[model samples]
Target: MNTSKRLEQALKKLYTAFHHNKLNPECCKQCAVGNILDNTDNWKYLSDSHGALELNYIGKVHQALGRKFNGYTPLELLKIERVFLNACNYKLPLHYKNEKPKNPTDKDVLFNGLNEVVKFLCYLDNISNVMDYTKLFEFENDKPKYKLVFTN
Candidate 1:
């Protein structure tokens, strides 16, 4: 039908797949919508002492003095958050809430899907410069043992 509808269909298809067992865990996402946002630096920051470093790095945007925003990119953090939310008690699917998605064959619902994902990506790219991308996370770090500095 339309672009939005197409994306919604994609989302339902992917969600259904994940709900059942149709697609891979990481590949079925819409613009990499933070499927596994947390702990993303372990592989994404692959470089100097930071790559898989102890998550220490913060401070003024880029200059970051004593450190502040360190950790991982907003995109990465989102992935982690999504994964966590998915596992949380409140993230159950509509079907799971009322009925049950046990047989996720063609019974998937395209609620928001990729349209939501595209909007998010656009938002991210739009405000990429003014935002730290990392601060938008609920990174449950009580004390934040590590610091993450953005070399970008």
Candidate 2:
């Protein structure tokens, strides 16, 4: 299969996993993508402390990638955003009938945020096989948070 098709399939799997709540909440804290979703200290600045599944969240991902990866460029971020927006059906506040509606339910917010995070992680995995995100998730309280381990 082509790279784009592979990415779409992987993102669909990630979205399904998130819809099932298969990820540890704390994982979002350790991952660049998750940090963007949860508005963690590492990326909250990009969204003014607001965490949403909006396309704008990609900005945080772009910034994080630039800061962490020496040669990463905006072109890569643009591609990632294009894929993400497509997966989300281009959902944005502007698409809503009203200019501003009530806050989304907590479940909806979590679903959207986690879905975006999962998609971003999948994108990174596709681009570089160096990230081991499975090891980045922590579920048990007794276990320490997993550190990001980049192979190269």
Query: Which pairs clash in the backbone of model 2?
Result: none
TM-score of each: 0.25, 0.28
Q: What are the per-residue Cα lDDT tens digits for candidate 1 across 1-152?
A: 12333334434544554455443212323212322231123332322221122233331222233321233353333443243223221232222244322332222222223323444433433433222345545356565444555666
Candidate 2's TM-score = 0.28
Best-matching candidate per lDDT: 2
Could you tell me the lDDT of residue 87 within candidate 1? 28
Positional deviation of 92 in candidate 1, in angstroms?
A: 7.2
Q: lDDT of each structure?
A: 0.32, 0.41
Model 2 Cα RMSD, 1 decimal? 13.7
Candidate 2 lDDT over 1-152, as tens digits, reads: 12454355545544554555543232333222332233234342344322243325555667656643222233333343333333333343223452321433234544554456455645565653322356456657877476553566
